[model samples]
Target: MGLNIKNETTHELVRRLAALTGQSQTSAVEDAVRRRLAELEQQQSADEEERRRRIRAVIRRAQQLPSTGRTTEEIMDELYDETGMPR
Candidate 1:
């Protein structure tokens, strides 16, 4: 099979690659482009899953909080008692 890709690419760089590795510009460019795309897809999938997990944790914490809230001073006193904070 043969690959034909036509776009703006550096001719001098292609010439140097052909001289060094005896492979055409199409082969080298195709391999490099495919690898880069694979890397991007993997990273994007991992990032999306992490974002979803963090959002779920935040939602769970919000759901556990009481609607009938204590005063700010009462909340601070409770926190201080729990942690043995200084007056």
Candidate 2:
């Protein structure tokens, strides 16, 4: 099975696709649009997984931290520094 996108796309976009790839205008536009959509979807999935992992890590760390309390920002800063985010 395959997915189909239906809409009116600009001729200039089609032309640019053709120029960038060496394919016919229609084929270039179709391929370029398909490739870009696939990349965006894959990146979105990766980002969602990363976000979930971060949230879970935060939850676990919060449970372990002292009840006498540090701010959320402080906890996050500690995690970031520990992860060498500024490296």
* Per-model TM against the reference: 0.53, 0.52
The prediction achieving the highest TM-score against the true structure is 1
- Across 2-51, the per-residue lDDT of candidate 1 in tens digits comes to 75545446666666766677778677666667879999999999999999
Residues 1-87 of candidate 2 have per-residue lDDT tens digits of: 764445446667776778888899768867877999999999999999999999999999989977856887787786777666952
lDDT of each: 0.77, 0.81
Q: In model 1, which residue pairs have backbone atoms overlapping below 3 Å?
A: none
RMSD of 2: 12.9
Clashing pairs in 2: none
Best by lDDT: 2
| Clashes (N, CA, C under 3 Å) per candidate | 0, 0
